[model samples]
Every structure is written in structure tokens, then in C-alpha cells.
Target: MDKRLIVVLVVFLFVLWYALRTAQIPPASIQASAEVFYINNETVTIVEKDGWGLFTLEVKPRISGFTFEIEFPEGTEYLIKVNGKEYRGNTTFKTTIDKDSEIYINFRLPDEDTKKLYRGEGQYYLTIKASKLPIWYVEYKIKLIPRKEKD
Candidate 1:
């Protein structure tokens, strides 16, 4: 056997081993889920099942309200629920792909009612239901800290 050929074969084997070792294998379930929680600004990628592409969810927190926006793939429709209740007025908030897949929701926080309901800190649940795909749900906890009064 040629010395150069043996060296080439050894290098190829190492590369193959490295590639396999670093590769990430997704879960086997038909549904996949991811979550991101932030106080101010953040972007989260929602991966679809069966190796489909991902979508982005952008969250922005402001002094008065919190904003949520979702950018989904084409030809997809979705419904959102907050804390086991449907968001806003609609029975089911729906959005289609042909139009903008980005859906936005804004909520005012720390109000008297909200403070009483949350009791300073509590867990909140969010559910995203694709019209065709399986249901996906995420849970987040919020803590309210009292700020010291300026002297």
C-alpha cells in the first residue's frame, strides 16, 4: 500500500468521525417545541415537525405592556391561547399564511386586577395551535419585585 494513500484514508476517517460526533439528532416525536423567556427583548425559533423549517417569535416588554409577534411559515394557520383562555375577543384567533403570518398581541401588566390575580408572582401558560399540526404549549413564570423608592 502507498504511504500517501494510507495517510489520506486516515484523514478521511477522522473527518467522518468528527462529523458524526457533532451532529445533532432531533427527537423522534412528530411534534417539536421550544421556548424563550426574557424581560425586555428576545427572539425564539419554533421548529416544525418532520424537519420542516422554523419560525420566529419576537417578544418585547415595555413599561406599560408586553408585545408578542410570531412569524410563521407559508401556508400555515395558527391559534393562540393564554393561561387556558382564548386570547382577546375571538373564540379562536386565527391567521393564514397567504397574508402575514405575523400575529401580534399586546397586554398591559401590573394593573390592580392583574396584581391581585397574579399575587406578585405566578405561572402563565401559552398555547399555540396550528390549524393542521399538533398543539404546542409553553409555560412561563413571572416574578414581581418591589422597587425601592428614590430618597
Candidate 2:
């Protein structure tokens, strides 16, 4: 091969390598206001005929893997949803005050899926429902951690 052609090829390869090495992926951005929600002694009654008791709370979560601790008076069936999406339980029930970290009455989203909540600032609804009646003193504590980015 000609010397000029060889030099040009080497230069091109070097430039390409430099460009690729220096390139950085932009960090994911979120307009989120981290917050914590607490529900103390809220009344919830589920008639035996209806078979379900329900309530909703508003919160803003900026990051994933948050802890949602809940508590109730007795053993009752219940379900919880965040913006219409069901929260997974640590064991049998996701949110038991209608659900705690210590006694395992907590709920949370996986790392991959929680981005939907951190996209922007808006009203995020957390709905808790019980399958039957008579467990009063429903308490819920939802702690949302703020996302910190490097400047």
C-alpha cells in the first residue's frame, strides 16, 4: 500500500477511537419533587356485601425503590395501587393499613418501572382498598427519596 494511504487510515482509526472513547451517555433527567405521605387513623369501612373498601392518597415520588409502610388493626385482605398500577407485596399483602417494613406490610416498584412516576410534577394517586370490613386505624407512610445527579 502507498505510504499516504497507510497514514490516512491510521489517522482515521485514531480519530474514531478518540471520538468513541470520549463520548458519554447523557444521564436520565426527571422533574420530580420528592415527598413523604403519612395517613394516621383514617377511617375505612368495607361492608361484607360489597366485599371491598377503598381510599386514595396523593403523593409525588422522584425515584424508584421507595418504602411504603402500612399498618392495620387485624388480618384483612387488601390491595394498593399507585396511579392505577398495583404495588407488589413483600409477601401476602402489598398495603395492609388498607399494609410496614418491619412486619412486611409494605409495597414498592422495581427499579426499571418507577421512572413513570418521576417524569414530571403532577398528582400521583395511591389507592388502598380492603376486601372486607372492621379493621380501623389505617395508617400509611410512603417515603420518596430525591434523585441526586452529578453536576
Best by TM-score: 1
- Model 2 residue 123 CA deviation in Å: 32
- Per-residue CA lDDT of model 1 for 28-105, tens digit only, reads 111223333344543232222221222223322111121222322222234444333344432223432222123333
Give the Cα lDDT of each candidate: 0.33, 0.35
Query: Tens digit of lDDT per residue, candidate 2, span 1-151?
Result: 6999999999999998877665532221211121322335432222221222233444323222333344422233445564455654332344322121112122333333234335433212233222222111122233332244559
TM per candidate: 0.26, 0.26
Name the lDDT value of residue 116 in candidate 1. Answer: 38
Model 1, global lDDT: 0.33
Q: Global lDDT for candidate 2? A: 0.35
What RMSD does model 2 have? 19.7
Error at 112, model 1, angstroms: 6.1
Off by over 4 Å in 2: 1-51, 61-65, 87-151
